[model samples]
Target: MTGDNAVNIGSPQPPQKADVLARVCAALSAGDADTAKAIIDTDYPMVIGTKAQRRYTLTETLRTFYRDGFLDRYSGTQLIHPGALRTLSMLLPKEFPAHLNGKMTETHFAQWELFPTIDHVDPVARGGADDASNWVTTSMLRNSAKAHWTLSELGWTLHPPGDARHWDGLSSWFTGYLTDRPDLASSSGYLRRWLRATRVVQAERA
Candidate 1:
């Protein structure tokens, strides 16, 4: 698969809420529940663009959402950039768990004003040696969603939604936890850690 067809660089313009939603849809269509969860769990903050001034309040809201299982039921159909949608479809079935079957489709593609745009590069230019190298280099970005989401859940008690501090803390915690459990690493693990750390941090803050 060519890189253009395999991964979406997105528009040079910053992604809007709709754009991100489309990406989530594409991720789901590809049966990538993990990616979908990461989008909701991590990108929501980016979309909200909140500051770090009220760490404790922000963290609490995020933790509450997770604790209440709001996220588990937040599934929906979304539009995706065509390249990304195709790429994700090719990738997800091989990688994701079976429980998320049929979650991705074009049915809701237009509902959220999310749609795919064509990229300049040939999507097929994505899987050769150079592509492989680039993929490895970029793998960190893909792997980070789960870590960021986990950290967000954990740090929710300290930072507000969209706070950069929360993202930083999530990255730090993810790195620390993944160092010990590389094989067990996943969005689910991140959620569990968030729950565990939230209690610990709450006690400290208390």
Candidate 2:
């Protein structure tokens, strides 16, 4: 597959939220629950350590960064969860902001541009192992664009991994947000899961 169909995550022009929603609607209408399900389940549990450890080392331990050279955020509230967007799109389309519906705007960044996901560097379809070594961190947008294509096929190159020492993906800010809005933890299992994992990692470092 050529990169022509891929959305340029590095570009100043973002993809339209309407376009993405339409894709999801089409997938669902066509009885392609798997596609809609994949779109809805964009959360990366590995980043937060909420996912169970594998028998071998995991790609989850890999440093987080946008493959396209954009800034990265920790896999937390800074990144919009697909579940949240799915709900809003269904119940509140009327109230959806014009900018979000028109062209993809800053509001959609959390959902598309910056949401971290694990991708197979060498796609499994082409015989790449489904293990840690073959996996890398990428934005949900790029992950979708890259569906089953190799880097050479797409004429893309792998960027270096990020160092937490320099950029912690606003992890400190996430900690502070949780502290200040503790009540949100009760309603959001996502927040609670990350909070627990964050504390565990912090304790280990301490």
Clashes of each: 17, 0
Global CA lDDT of candidate 1, please?
Answer: 0.35
TM-score on alpha carbons, each prediction:
0.17, 0.50
> What is candidate 1's lDDT per residue for 105-156, written digit by digit as tens?
5223221222211111111222112221111111111223322233234332
Poorest stretch of ten by lDDT in candidate 1: 132-141
The reply for model 1, stretches above 4 Å from the true place, is 1-13, 46-206
Between which residue pairs do clashes occur in model 2? none
In the range 1-206, model 2's lDDT, one tens digit per residue, is 35879766566564455666677788899999888766544521112212222332211232222221223222222232223343344345556422334266524344566555667776666566676677666667787888877787688876655545445455555666667767755666755665565555445545
Tell me the lDDT of candidate 2: 0.52
Error of 2 at 165 (Å): 1.2
Q: How big is the positional error of residue 160 in model 1, measured in Å on the Cα after superposition?
A: 27
